[model samples]
Target: MIDKILNIKELNYASSLNGDNLKQKIEDLFERPAISFFGNFTSQTEFAAYDKLSVISWYVPNFKRKSAYLKGEILKSGKGTLIKLNIRPNTMLSVASIVSVLVGIIILIAAGSSTRFLIVGSFFILVGILYYSFGIFSRNRLRTNFEKTLDLHKV
Candidate 1:
């Protein structure tokens, strides 16, 4: 069995076993994610897995309460097994985030009228960027950590 990361955000490769067997092995490797503390915050960092699918999520320390997660699916490809992972953010939060960034741009454009708008707009823009960035970072970090923990790259 050979595993490879197609990109920083996705991991997949070829396996000789069926999807059920492969998924079980992954579950065994991680066992269960531990709860860790950062300052006064106690957050859960873990994934839920089944025979053909897995969903991974963890807490982000950002001021805004946002959750990040990834979904993986196993499929049969040719004579081998193929596993793919991706983030689907078509939710309200994702939409609001994009709107925030656009609103920030509008505020900046209206800034010539008042410095107050500039300040507010800047704040919005910063928050929007952080929200978006944290979402991406969280998803990738979890996937990377999983691969590293299991030494999948070399497998």
Candidate 2:
């Protein structure tokens, strides 16, 4: 589900394609079909992010990890173009992880004579931390990727 639709003002696609073609190209570039399309000069996508702002949406291969869905639109303006995007995070997994850690803590507190409970709780805590760390790692990776995708200004 889309959570936040970002507004990108005065964007320059530097392309000559008509509105429909340009919208299709944008969706194709994102690899996700858009959910809606507007007037002769407007279109909307259910999932798309600027190559930079979408850093947090990157996916990692793990059962604990989750996917983020996005939605937005592109419209022709006076000189450039206007873009509106909604980025949503699959926070259920993270919330579940937090719950797991809490469960683990409770198990430990009540696991007086059971090593199994202690181990299980510890495992939950470790997994929670690891999954959370992966999110951070992916976001940092996005930053680097974004920079590489853009030409650096000459000093």
Candidate 3:
């Protein structure tokens, strides 16, 4: 039964699910082939004080042969909240960029004041910045293409 469903040309044939239901459905499909989920949570605090609030908590899944899925919740603290859309590669790239940036910062800080060490440290920082920016750009372009493909299928 699963194989037959998988072989079909159209996987997202059912359009009734949206929001939370859609999220659940995608999560349920993770056991299948060539699919994985990426989870992220972001919080914001006012004035760097004790009032910390979770702004977004969500998961995005990218499938090998199907449209990528977005599933998550947004906490409405003010005017409104937004669920992250069109984010799969973007999430991965953002993670990569963050890791690279942190490493670069640490290296540069440790190098401190020495001319030779400063040169090497600066190189690392430059490389990190390049990698981070490239990753972000690639992710955004990939996401846009994926979204276009999804829209095409819906028609």
- By lDDT, who's the top model here? 1
Regions more than 4 Å wrong, model 2:
1-24, 30-66, 75-79, 112-115, 134-155
Candidate 3 overall lDDT versus native: 0.38
What's the TM-score of each model vs. the native? 0.59, 0.45, 0.37
Residue 56 of model 2 has an lDDT of 40
Pairs that collide in candidate 1 are: none
Report lDDT per candidate: 0.51, 0.45, 0.38
TM-score of structure candidate 3? 0.37
The residue ranges of model 1 lying beyond 4 angstroms of the native Cα positions read 1-11, 16-20, 35-66, 88-93, 153-155
Model 3 residue 132 CA deviation (Å) reads 1.8
Which TM-score value belongs to model 1?
A: 0.59
* Clash totals for all candidate models: 0, 7, 0
Which is better, 1 or 2, measured by lDDT? 1
Residues 1-155, candidate 2, lDDT per residue (tens digit)?
A: 12111111112233344456656665454453332211122234233442232324657565323233334455566644444433333454355556767877888898898999889888988876665554444433433332233321211
Model 2 weakest lDDT span, ten residues long:
1-10
Residues 1-155, candidate 1: write the lDDT tens digits: 11111122445645676767766666566455452101110112223321211222444454333243445566677766665655432133454556788899999998987989999998888877765665555555555555554444321
lDDT of 2 at 79: 46
